[model samples]
Target: QKEVEQDPGPLSVPEGAIVSLNCTYSNSAFQYFMWYRQYSRKGPELLMYTYSSGNKEDGRFTAQVDKSSKYISLFIRDSQPSDSATYLCAILDYGGATNKLIFGTGTLLAVQP
Candidate 1:
């Protein structure tokens, strides 16, 4: 099975709205990192890195993970149209192999002005 699973959202939100994104996994080896991705000139860029369970906040963005439940999330406060993009969740299995990375299909977010 895939190591991580994220919502393939075509989610729309108005300006200043709070946006929530989510993912889930079924691997214990996923204790390493949960990465958030946004589109770049080349392709998907690693936007945020979160470790273990609990929440990590960076400015208007927050990444949360629940190791016990195998759940992960990202929250955006005061959403903006510039934030519109396809976001992906990635997991690294350090316990399994050397840099075995897995990624979700991605969720598309559209913040309307």
Candidate 2:
């Protein structure tokens, strides 16, 4: 039998609701991090964040970043089932001349209608 240490979640919430998702990192060497929304099990992209300690809002979404705490959060308002997917917390480390991006295990969310 394969060992399962941790399981990804299916965090279910109702449609038209508000939700907050948080992630924490232990690495201080990371240059920055971003929140990626993945759909249909496809690979997530880097068309996301540029971080600083504060809240950034656009439309129905808000991102909270705290460098000292190594914490970040994504808040969504007026959620929909169409938004169901895996959310990943990613950090890019530009060490030396090479750029390395690391990803969290990802948390799957399902917004129920």
Q: Largest lDDT belongs to which candidate?
A: 1
Give candidate 2 misplaced runs (Cα > 4 Å): 1-7
**lDDT of model 2 at position 14:** 97
TM-score of each: 0.89, 0.83
Q: Kindly give the stretch of ten consecutive residues in candidate 2 with the minimal lDDT sum.
A: 1-10
On residues 7-107, what C-alpha lDDT tens digit does candidate 2 reach at each position? 35768999999977777777666556677888885888543575657777777778777879777777889999887888877777666797866677777
List the global CA lDDT of all models: 0.82, 0.73
lDDT of 1 by residue, 53-100 (tens): 888888999989888889888899999998888888888867535676
Model 1 TM-score (2 dp): 0.89
lDDT of 1: 0.82
